[model samples]
Target: MPTPHRPSAPPAGRVDAIVLGTSAGGVEALTHLLPTLPHDFRPALLIVVHLPRHLPSLLVEVFSVRCRLPVHEAADKQPIQPGTVYFAPPNHHLLVDRDARGPSLALSADAPVHFSRPAIDVLFESAAAGYGKRLGGVILTGANADGALGLQAVKRRGGVTLVQEPSTARAPTMPQAALAAGEVDFVLPLEQMPAVLRAWGDGGAI
Candidate 1:
């Protein structure tokens, strides 16, 4: 068997998709981040926020009112569309997979990891595999360590990784864990993330 050559790190402005993981303060964090993205922001945004599995998720409805992009709750086997915001639906883990047609979203009802059905790790790992160097992984405010290893996996694939600055996060544990993993490419305040994403969306430096 031959070793596969990994591509060089992608330019900050070359991001094709984004996968974000947050928990405890997710709604507030997303409220601040989504509305600030430029209307024409190009990369598709995928998100996972910890929620009760049994109840219906209203995340798409809530975010659609404020987000610059159209928001949709991910449905199983749906193709990922650019410039859209997709949220993991309650009770299922959202995953990204590449097929002959292109990248598509998948939903799984497997047992929970880190006590979360829609675990951040599940989404991050799958997106990292699907998008590789073109993906950008973000870890935001949360109380658990769900996203740490998955973010590291993104970095290992030469993808850019960002973590919220611990001091500024509503819950610092998640960001702190990712930072401790020693793979994050940037640590920034939440207020600055949307601008960075906007710049990346514009093909400008992040």
Candidate 2:
């Protein structure tokens, strides 16, 4: 077997999971960010986006084709795994179970937060509670302030938080909100986010 690249083993302050929140212009941002990663990129990623409850999700289809990582819609109680990507299906709240030995998914019909069913705050808060400092959060391009508070929650839990820089985003609202709400560890453009996250996945990308 080929030896693993030393840098790929897991970075300092290594994070095992990432939770992303995006909206409005997210598809374009995600398109760029997902396609560039290596298949073995270490962090298990979960994401949420606002969508109509009745509509089917194209996110899984889109990212699966665009990303090297395996991608799918989250199923209730499914355990979180490394080397994969999961997207919250339209209409439900997607949450992470904090139990490390048995990290799991939770689906809920809880009323929408920030007018979104799969609200960013719900995902981030759950992830914070579950993963604590092992989690990393990114608030990408969007039309609303949904992710700002959630990103704060992640920071409060000692997890790293990142926000897409407003000027670089296709939609500036969400990123702006996140930045305005609290300080984040990283403020990156779309192109840099994947690289930054990949660096975090392996070892310190700082």
Candidate 3:
């Protein structure tokens, strides 16, 4: 495989939150990534993984056991907590909101973008607007082009963007689409992601 890409310069600031999006092969991909985050990992993680709209998601239960950090299905209006991982509930669109109390999660029933309700684009775009340069956006394996524009929005707002190396992905279309949209900070294999995320969360050079 080709060498992974890294940014020319280290990121400028701490990443307060990370927005992750995926679909096909997402469960296995997340299993590899999230469990590697140390218990004290500083940034909050908001994740969107495509799921059957009618069935309840078991992501929280599944990851809570594997990850050292707290994991929950995102609740409407729940405050974003550092070190925790929140997955968008089935059938709902997850978004980021900021208010006097600070940043929180928001769920929407509005029409899906790219035919997925918990669309990667919805979460990524909202996080870009809410957290701006303090946010980090990651696009992993998926079958379609859901996350491309959202990752573009992250780059436009001066946030850090990362995509799984397309050749290493179980389903490459999503990552490929994200790469086609524009430049990103990194294109890494899943094995390398946790370290970079740790560096970003710790406000250190990667």
Best-fitting candidate, scored by lDDT:
3
lDDT of 1: 0.89
- How far residue 186's Cα lies from its native spot in candidate 2, in Å, is 0.8
Structural RMSD, model 3: 5.7
**Local accuracy of candidate 3 as per-residue lDDT tens digits, 1-206:** 96564566555447899999999999999999999999999999999999999998999889999999999999999999999999999999999999999999999999988999989999999999999989899999999999899999988998898999999999999999999999999999999999899988987778
Off by over 4 Å in 2: 1-13
TM-score of each: 0.93, 0.91, 0.94
- Model 1 clashing residue pairs (backbone): none
**What's the true lDDT of residue 60 in model 1?**
88
Task: Say which prediction, candidate 2 or candidate 3, comes out ahead on TM-score.
Answer: 3
Q: Report model 2's TM-score to 2 decimal places.
A: 0.91
How well is each residue in 1-206 modelled by candidate 1, as lDDT tens digits? 96563455234457789999999998999999989887788999999999988999999889999987999999999999999999999999999989999999999999999999899999999999999888889999999999999999888887788999989999999999989987678899988888777765665654
Query: What is the lDDT for 198 in model 3?
Result: 93
Can you write out model 2's per-residue Cα lDDT over 104-191, one digit (the tens) per residue? 8888999999889999999999998888888899999999999899899999998888898899988899999999998899998787
Report how far off residue 3 is in candidate 1 (Å).
Answer: 32
Highest TM-score: which candidate? 3
